[model samples]
Each structure stands twice: as structure tokens, then as C-alpha cells.
Target: MYTTRNSSSSCTQGGFNLGVMHIGAPACGMNAAVRSFVRNCIYRGDTVYGIHDGIDGLVEGNIQEMTWAEVTGWVGQGGAFLGTKRTLPEKHLDQVAARLREYKLHSLMIVGGFEAYHALLQMYEARGKYPEFCIPMVVIPSTISNNVPGSDFSLGCDTALNEITEICDRIRQSAQGTKRRVFVVETMGGYCGYLATLAGLAGGADAAYIFEEQFGIQELQLDVYHMAAKMAEGVQRGLVLRNEKANENYTTDFIFRVYSEEGKGIFSCRKNVLGHMQQGGSPSVFDRNMGTKMAAKAVTWLTDQMLAHRREDGSVFCDEASTAVLLGLQRRSYVFQPVIELKCQTDWDRRIPLNQWWLKLRPLLRILAKHEAAYHEEGITVKEVEEALD
Candidate 1:
């Protein structure tokens, strides 16, 4: 016998009823958005339910009903008031189907990322097997990596980027009075550089190291040493940005050696790599405002929007990118603009900071090249020489 947990809450507005279930990780920022939405729904006299531990809870008949007051003020909180889990009910499809049928859930607001997508797709695929498993699901991509292909940005990216920039700003200020200091500040980016690149631009770093651009350690060392030499001469301040996707210890140690050799005081902003505390802070003002707006829209979409779908693999797939994803509207379009305002066309005057820094250190590059006859002795390519100079 398998058991699952689920939550249920109901509200009525204008003689119409509404019900919702939340299923996703609390750390990913969907919880706050969903909580905000739930509160709004209750204010508007709509019903809602919290599915504890995500879809797994939905499969086991473990459910608790909730009300607006139960989830109030959660908009500012970090973790989900309704919990989450990754367990898929595919193994026990029948049990899951039976539970869904019994619960008579009206709509499920899945507050998760790719995993949630897959889970919902699977659940929908199996829905035909059970007569009782029929409900509309709206998916909210809430991953920190901000790589949900269709959505412009994941739910939590704005808040995460803001926090990263705040940290970088504080660190930059703290570096004042320190000569030749090179801090390799690391930020989270599992498989995407959106966060790192945006943070670097917003934080005004001298250089941004991201997975999108493969950076060799040897080149980084030479570059740091060159920068340190310049800083020692007169340039008192500089910033080196690092994305966590790359090797953390290796990069930090390499940059630290350059600063240590120059006798410059170096300090990195202390942070928990796992980021539990960082993830738990109150949502930023932007997030709160956006969250409120998104929640209200969600109620409208579920009630009035005719969600379109397409057939795939002999089955119908709801347009995840269009219907479910909540990329905030910008100028009447659903898009999340990058934190760093990017110019598609390059301006010589606005070259990337790394390129600008390299230009500043061109004289040093020439000085270092005088000792090595790589162009003549090794017949190195122009690209190699350019890279070496950088």
C-alpha cells in the first residue's frame, strides 16, 4: 500500500469556485510566488490546496486543506509553505491515478523546473489509464540556472542576480585601500552562465569568467599577474568575476597566489556554497511586486485562458513554453530582460571589461613578449599570440 500527501484549499469569487495545488521545491522561489498567488486567490474568494512534497504527495492521499490566512505573508518568505519532493509516481501509476481521482483536485500549479515538466508530462501520459485523473496543470519554471529554454528567465533568477550583485558591490567597496588585490568572486551557475555573465556586468567587474567562454588556467594566471602589476603601479582597484560552474578552488588559489606574491591584501566575500541562507531571504521588492502581479494573472489564465496544445509522440503536449511558463510581460510581451543591458552590436568605446583591461595592459604585454620569441622560435599562430597577450 502506497501513501501520498496533498493539500487542498477552496475559495469562491463572483459565484465561481477556484482550487489549486502547489508541487515543487521551496528553495527555487516558486513557493513564494505560489504563496502570494494563493493569498490573492483567497482574497478574491478562490479556493486553494498545498500539495506537500510535490507530486509524490498528490499520489498518496495525504492531503491537508488550507485557507488564505494559512499562507498569508508567505510572499516575503523564501521556502515554500507547501513542501516539495522529486519522487515520480510512474512506478505505481495505478495508486497515483487512484489518489488523484479520489482527491477531485481541480487545478495543479506545479512550481518547479525541468523536473516538474517531466513529471507532469509523465503524469499526463498516464492520465488516460485512470478515469479519475483529470485536472489542468500550469507549470512555473523556477530554477536558479535560468536555462528553461522557452522561458526568458526562471522564477528566481532576478532575486538571485540581485543578491549576487549586492554581494559583489559590498566586496568591491571592501577592497578599497588594498593594493594589487584580485578577488575571484564565485557565483552559482550549474550549466548556464546567465547568472555569472549578468552579475559580472551589473557588478562592474574587470573580467567575467563563464562556462560560455572556455578560460584556461595558464591564461588566467598570466592575466591576473599582468593586472596585479598594473594595480601595484597605480591602479588601486579591480574586479575578477568567476562563475561557480568552473573549478572554484583552482581558480581562487591561482588568483590568490598572484595577490600574495605582490603582498596585496585579498579578501573574498564569505558565503555558504550550498546557499541555504542565501536562498531563504525575503524576496526583493521587484520580486514581491512581480509575484503579486503574476499570481493575479494566474487566476485569470486558469479561469479564462484557453490553453492550446500540440500533438507529440502520439500524444498531446500542452504548449509548456507559451501557456504554462510565467516569463513576466515586458512592454506587453512576456520576456525577462537580462539584468545587464547588453548591446548586440559592439562599441569600441564599450568593449567588454576584460578586453578593456587587456587594452590597458597592452604595454605590459609587449614587455612580457620581448623575452619570449614565440612568434619567431615556435611559429605560434596570431590567435595564440593574441590569447597570450590577453
Candidate 2:
């Protein structure tokens, strides 16, 4: 934050004054990401300010320059150490611009979910209205949902998937001990189904319901039949995972009851909603490393752009790097995508990216789960059914 800290020149003498903040819901690896950002920025001769919260906090002027020792032992830490909120920047754009001017932040880095992304986006769109918002900015996709635009993977998605998979393992153990039983587990992903679909792939669940691919009574009936078939085939236990918002009419308990009624003589059903527990716990090693790498890349990218665009008058020229961007891991490479460019990729109604890369994987999960598809029935086009999915 370094807000109101003796004006911009004091901190800008040696390097640019950069600000980092955690926004939106807390997730594992957030602290780690901030730690890396602070360390990397300082290491590169730049002063890093820790914005206490999201855009709302900026208006309150709760910002401070961070020291390397302050982030000591934050590698595997989880949650928002600097605090966070879900406030968008639309209403407080003027206040945010004032803080940016006061803090003298040459660049800003936000680490959080879609809430943070959208909030920053409001400012990005208003760069012409507020000259202070012209500096380079970037978001490190940190949501467990993995639904942020331009990113194939988000920071905490893997950790949340691991948590869901582990819980599914324990549930499966209980169901296996009591043979011919099915467990309906619900995971949190808001409207996104990345967590549910990935958990299914990792835990070998027989079924995983996601919002991206709509499911209804017919799908539920097919799922029930699949569970019964698994039981009749002498399978010890069955597992089903549903994203919290997978379907409006179908819920975890609803599916459980349906299964219980259909498998009256064959099996029993139990339902477990894994609420906020998935958002807690230390981030996985993969997340810690990924956070470190992504933070380093973001800081480096921002500084490089600022310097390249810096001029004799001390004002940086706007360029590709000056635009607000999201640092996302796409395929094998890490790419920086402009935040404004993501508008078309976003489903504003759902607050998730449109045509998600992982949505295509949902049908594969359904196929692997062995759901009763047209291929298993007569007079139903298998290709049409397959095409209908995802």
C-alpha cells in the first residue's frame, strides 16, 4: 500500500512503487502468492506495498510497504494474511484512483478470484476517466473454482481438488466397508464445475455433476441406474460428486433420496455437503511452487514493462504491458492476458469464463463414469448424445 508515505518520489528513487493485495474469498496459497510478490519485487530493487484488502480497503487507505522479513515462513500458509473483500471498483472508482495517486503505485498486482478480477476490470475500463489507473496491473488467478478467464488453471484449484479427492477417499472407505452403499458428495465451486469434474477424475467417482453441462431428472435417473448397475456388478461402493450449483432442481440430497428409493433392495444412500472446509487447510506443495513462480513472473513482467515504457519525463508510455492483465497458466506455458480482452471470454451472468477449456473434459468424466448413454440403449443416436454433452 505505502499509501500517504511521504509522496511518490521517496519510494520511487530506487525503483517503482508496486502494490500487492488479496481480494475476494480466501483460499490456500494466497499468502504464499503475496509473499512471493513482495519478495520478488523487493529483490528486483522495487518497493512493494501490501494493500490491506481489496478495492474497498484501498479507499480506506490501509496500505503499507512490506519488508522481506515480514513474509518469513509464509510459503505453505493459507488464507488471506493481508485481509480481503469482494467489493467491486465501480462505485468507488474515484476513491480508488485517489489512493492510487496518493500511494504512487507504479504497478498493482491483485491475487484472488473472479471478484477481484471483475473489480480491477472496472478500473481498467475507466483508465481514460482516471489517469492514476493507467499503470500496469495484473491478477494472479487464485480461485479454487479455476473459472477465471484466459487461465487453464487457477492457484488454489489443485489444492481444492486434492481436498475433495481426499474426502471422497474417506467416504469411499466407509461405503466400501458397508458394501452396496452410495455416497453423494457435494463440493463448492459456485456455478463452475472444475472442482467437481477434476475430483471425479482423481477419485474415480462413478458420477460427477457440474453446472457447465446441465443435468436434469433424466440424467439423475440414468445416474441412479448406473449406481444400481455398479452394485449389481458386485462393486463394493459407489461415489457421486455434485458441484454445489450444478443444477437448480437437482441437489445432493435430492439425488441421494432418488438413489435410495430406486435401490431400495440393493443399496443405501448418504449425502455430504463439503461446505467451506474445502477452502481451508495449507496449500499443496504444487500450489506453493506455482504461486512462487507466478508471482515472480508477474513482478518481472510488470517491472520490465514499466521500465521499457518509462520516459525522460518520468511518465510511462502505455503499451501492451501497461494494460491490465491476468497471469494464467495456459497449457504448458504461463501467459499474461489483458483483463479487458477477457470480456468476451466471460459469461457476465455467471461470473465465469465462457467456453471453459475444462468444460470439454466433463463429457469424458461422464463417459468414464459409465453413465447410461444412448450407446447402451436402442434407437438413440450415441453421437448425438455425446455431442449434446459438454
Candidate 3:
């Protein structure tokens, strides 16, 4: 982890209480957002604290003020300015809260994934005791997984997709020699398939497989056989995209065995895990501008609000946790709000063919009942569901 707290400094007007704490590592594209935020804060004459190593750092009193000069030219950089850890507030909630009170922080801005949101809930639970310490938190979704709810695109997803496509494109180039080739490209995102799905589409994969679309072994075999047949007829190459988290190991074993039996001349596959590599490169123009814009919005919201005080001194005490704000693009503007959840249900079976006959004709009664229940819960339409599952 990188520590920048020693280089941090802040300017404050006497009797004014304002500070900000950031918790989380730079594994994703959060570093760009944090640096942009510091620039915006210092430019507006606001005093903020850079707490190293997130919640644990705060509890250990590893706090320092950030200066504009220290955070400039960091908008395009990846990772975080201040170091981050997976520490939870519940571990030492009392000590962490005490540190916030000591710093007299006005608000906090947490940039990370779901773990960061859980920290925000902890801070919200500490209201009504320190009115001067009331801190408003704003979260910027920075995970490559793009699993956060309320936002269509998170900060690091574009970078991750680009990374996967670049790797696959190179692999595709190499596999174009003499024999027919098959390549399996794997991507991160333990629970979500956003990266896999989009990467597959962008990479021009012949077939895309993801946990978001659960497929059975039988169907997978058929798809491979069909692709191999296409290659045998001089197609030369094929692309198979797989989601790492969904069943990478299983899919790889099954494909290799089936391809060998089909006399495809011992077909080969490549596995590319764009892990932390997705977090470090230079930020694209879109990410840099978006980071600055979001930072400005967060600052303005914190400064303009007339929040209630819980202490006798009438100082608005801010909590030391981050809150998630959903900002979705609509038309020509960004709609910022809170989101409840993001749906992630896989319902694909290869055993049953997805032909028109199966989809338009007979439907299983049990499956239909299950579909009704899922629809009531997910707001999805019946036609959108698979015949076997509906």
C-alpha cells in the first residue's frame, strides 16, 4: 500500500470545523477520483484530512491534511492517493469515531466497492452524539466489477473492458495460423458478469458465456462442436468468452475434452485474467473529466447543505463513513440518487435447446410458476424468460 499522509497539508480558518476521510485501496480506478476530489476541495479553500489505510488508519490516528500541490497531476493515475485496506469499522468502532471527533471532520468521501458502503452504514449509525462532527459522505463506485447498484457504469469498468479486448485481440491474431483455433478468455468480477458480457460483445466472440447467463454442459458441447465445424470449413478461428467467477475451471475442462473427441486436432485455449492490471493504467479522457465533475458535485453538496446538529455547541458533526449516491445518465444530464439493488440471476440451460419451437410452444408448468414468482420479485417480463425456466 502507498502512504501519502506525511506529504499531506491543509489550510483552515480559525474556529471552522471541516475535514474529510477516505478509506479504501487503489486496486480499482479510485485513485483518479480521490486525486480529482482533493484538487476540487483545496481549490475551494476547504480543509480535508487524508486518513491512511482507511478505517484502520483512522483508528490508529494516521491522519494528515492534504494540499493542492500534493494531489495535482494525479487525475489520470490509477490506484488510490491514500492507501486502503479491507478493515471494517465494527472491529473498533469506538476508536474510529473518536478519531473523527478529534479531527473535527465535516464530511467524508469514500471511494470503493460494496465494502465501502457497509462502512457508510456504520457511520450513519453514529448520529446525534457529536453535532460538530456531522460528516456527509459521498461514494464513487470504483470497482472494475461494475457490480454497484444505481449506476449503469462504474469508474473502472471501461478500463477493464479495454484490457480484456486488447488481450483477446492479440490472442486472436496469433491463433490465425494454419490450424483452426479456439481461445477462452477469462475476466474478473466474482459475482457480476458485466465485464465478461461487454468484453465478449466488443471482442467479437463467436460465443459468450457468463455467470449472468448460466449454461449447461450439454449446450456448451453443442456450441463448441458447431464452432469447430465452422472452423473445419476454413473458418480458421473462434472466440469463446468465459466469466472467471461463474465457472471458469469447469468450463475449461469440459471444452478441452469435447474438442479433443470431436477430432478438431487437439484444439487450444488461452486464459487471460485481467486482474489488478485493470486498476493501474492511465485514466481515459472520459474518466478524468467524470472524476473531476463528480468531485465538484460532492463538494458542493457537502458545503451547501444545512444539516441538523446533535451537540450543544451547534457544530455539525460528520460521520467517518462513505455513502453511495447513484448518478445515472439520462438524455443529456446525470441523475444522482440512491439505489436499492442490482439484479443478478442466471437462468440459461444448455440441455434444452433455445429453438423457436421450444420457446414458442410447450412450457413446463413448474417453470412457469417459478417464473411468476421471480417476475413478482424482479419486475422482469415472461417473454424475456427462457421456456424451460418459465
Candidate 4:
């Protein structure tokens, strides 16, 4: 077992040094989160270090002290300014710990999604073997997937949704003009269907194929038949929103092929993969505001932990336990949750349930898309029952 000396005591003599890095896929508003965190730390009289190239940088000991002017006006920026990597830190724990000590960074603020959190949890669990793993940390979820557990919304989700909705709207317009085309728009979500589901609802997609809904060949056949029936009923131009990894057996091309072949007389088909575009574009107002709020809270939390480590005898104890937390927006309120509770073995197997209210939107969207008349009739039936009871 490797042991780390209590070197953080030196940070108490001067202001504590904090580190920031981005990891996992690049998402809009990451720079905004970094900017806000850097500004807040500076404002609070702390030194901020930029970990270039994420955890890989830490392993390589590539670090640079950051100043406020360097990160000014970055709230609207898209992608990560610090540069992000998909590398896991578990393989390089010793080097990462050594780099932290070399820079004397007391805490590190991670700005990314699932993979980043997993790395943080791994480090926390390894604290017994590698005492340097005891460094306090904070994670700000910034994935377009919106799949991070324990949060209603992740940073950059709104911006990505906005982009997807806009692209779908344009595609719908083109389909409408053709008057006999069904546009299939494939979106990014990996296994989480939150993006596809919500974008379909907001974009008025005729149907959505999401991971949350277990889809099969039979379901696909039925969906195609229903879409053809809708076309026969004078509905022209349909939009289908699909999660990229929704169904392993069915690909976007396969879906388009089916629609083109089966709906021959009723409609033609076109496929559009919105690939990385969803991850680009300026951060939306929601993202900007959320990033700022979350980043500031993270800085404050880290600073408080540093102060708490001060001994009454004027000596600083670097070995003092620090909280490792994730800052998230839970039900319209900001929450600082323990990272241990948020840990999961796999992204697909979420530890916390996704927003149930948002999940409810999935079925509601389906009803709005394919069963509007039945929905309206059901509403009327409920109204009639209420009147009879009255």
C-alpha cells in the first residue's frame, strides 16, 4: 500500500490550491462550468490550477495555474476549454496522486458525466491504499446524455435538446414540403433515452424509439403499420426520433428501409444522423445559469472543507476527512450529494431512478403522436363521468 504524507498543511498557510478538469465526451457548457468555478475560486481568494487534457494531464503532471482573465467571458462557450479525455484515472492512480502533490492542489473539481463520476468513486474507494486519494473532489455533470443519476437535468442537456429540436423542426418542414416523406432523425444518447424521448416530444416527432421502451421487431412492424395508416388518413410527413443505441437489432438504416418499403405508396423515407451537432452550439440560458450556480457552490464547498481542516492550535491537519460530493439540480433545488451514494457499476444500471415525471412524458408523447383522438375522447369520457358524479 502506498502512503501519502500530509502535505496539504502547507495550503493552509497560504490560500488553498484547487484544480479543475473536464472528462468524458465533450459537451456544451463545460467551458462555462470551468469559467464559473475558476472565477468563484479567485473571488474567494483561492488559487486555481487548470488540468489540461483531463485525468491524463494529471497523470502526466501537466498543470498550469489559471487566472481570472484567462477564463473571462466563457459562459457562452461550447465544449471544454481545458480539453477533456475519456481516459479512466484508475490505471494511473499513483501518478495522479503524485501530480496533485507536485501542484499542491488540495481539491479537484471534475466537470463531466458518468465516466468521470465513476473515476471519482474509484479514487474514493482506494483512499485506504492510496492515502492521497483522500483529496476532496466535486463533480458537475455536463453530458448531453442527461443520464447522470440523482439529477433532474445535467449541464448541456438543454442546449443539446434545443439543437436537436431545431434540426428536427427543419427536417419536418422538408418532409412536409415533400408531402410523402417520413424523416428518421437519429440522436445521441448511448443507452439513456432521455434526450431522444424529450426531443421527440418537443420536436413533434411522429414516433420515438428510445432505450427506455423495449422495442422488438413486432413493435417496429406495428409502428410502421400505424404510421402508414396515419398517412392513409391524410397525415403527410412524419418525423421519427430514435436513440442511436436504442435497439441493437435495429439500426437507423434498417428503420428507414422498412419505412421506405412498407409505406411505398403513402410515404418515402430519409435518414438524418444528428451525430455530434447536438454536442456543439453555444450553451443555452439554462445551461449558463445552471453551470454558474453549480460551479460556485462547488468552489464554496471545497473552500469550506479546507478551512475545516485547520487545527485550533494553529496547525493544519491535511489528513482531515473531506467530503467528496456531486453538485446537482434535484427537483428545481440545488443539492450537494455524496459521491459514494451516486456510484454505479454501469451506466445502464443506474443507482438512482431517473426523473419519474420526465419518464411519464415518454408515454404522453406517444399518445400525443399516434393516439390524439383516443386521448381527447378519453379526456371527454372523464369529464362526462365527473359531471354524472356531480
TM-score on alpha carbons, each prediction: 0.67, 0.90, 0.75, 0.88
lDDT (tens digit, per residue) of candidate 3 on 347-373? 123211122222221123213222233
Residue 322, model 1, lDDT? 33
Put down candidate 2 lDDT per residue, 81-154, tens digits, no spaces: 99999888899988988998898888889999998788778878888789888888888889898878888888
User: Candidate 1, 267: how far from true, in Å?
Assistant: 11
- The lDDT for every candidate, in the order shown, is 0.52, 0.81, 0.57, 0.77
* lDDT by residue (tens digit), candidate 4, 1-390: 111122343334447788999888888888888888888778767789999998888888778999989998899889888889989888888898788767777788999988777777777877777766666787888899887776778898999999999888887776545667789889998878888888988888877887777777767777788888888898888888889888887989999888889888778889999989998678999899889878877776677666766457532234332366777777657777766766542344642244434665655676668655433423434444343333
Clashes of each: 15, 2, 18, 0
Which candidate, 2 or 3, would have the higher TM-score against the true structure?
2
Q: Can you list the residue pairs that collide in candidate 4?
A: none
Q: In candidate 1, which residue ranges exceed 4 Å CA deviation?
A: 1-31, 43-46, 88-92, 128-134, 229-233, 247-274, 305-332, 335-390
* Candidate achieving higher lDDT, 1 or 2: 2
* Shift of residue 209 alpha carbon in model 1, Å: 2.0
Pairwise TM-score winner, candidates 1 and 4: 4
